[model samples]
Target: MDSGIICNNALITLIAIQNPVDRKAIERIKEMKNWQKKEFGQEIITLLRSL
Candidate 1:
């Protein structure tokens, strides 16, 4: 549960930092194959790096 909260908060922070419109990045992230296996930090890093 702790990790879940952390991941959720991290996502909110990440999105807000990105001006809230680049939410497409978040959607693209959801569509990525095998997304469930990624750590929250890893996923965020990958998305940011691609930006």
Candidate 2:
């Protein structure tokens, strides 16, 4: 239950930081890949580091 709340809040915060359309796209991609919030965040960091 706690983890679910955290994931939900993290999604909301991520959406707030990015454009609304981009946020939905990202969320969908993450869901398709079956990634938890922490893994999704790590993937983002790795991608950013390569830029």
Specify the highest-TM-score model's number. 1
Cα lDDT tens digits, model 1, 1-51, are 676544566655655475322335555544333443243435655666776
TM-score for each predicted model, relative to the true structure: 0.29, 0.28
lDDT on C-alpha atoms for all candidate structures = 0.49, 0.49
Candidate 2 C-alpha lDDT tens digits along 1-51: 676644566664664465334334556544323455335555554554465
Candidate 2 stretches with Cα past 4 Å from truth are 1-36
Error of 2 at 42 (Å): 0.6
- Which residue pairs clash in candidate 1? none
lDDT of 2: 0.49
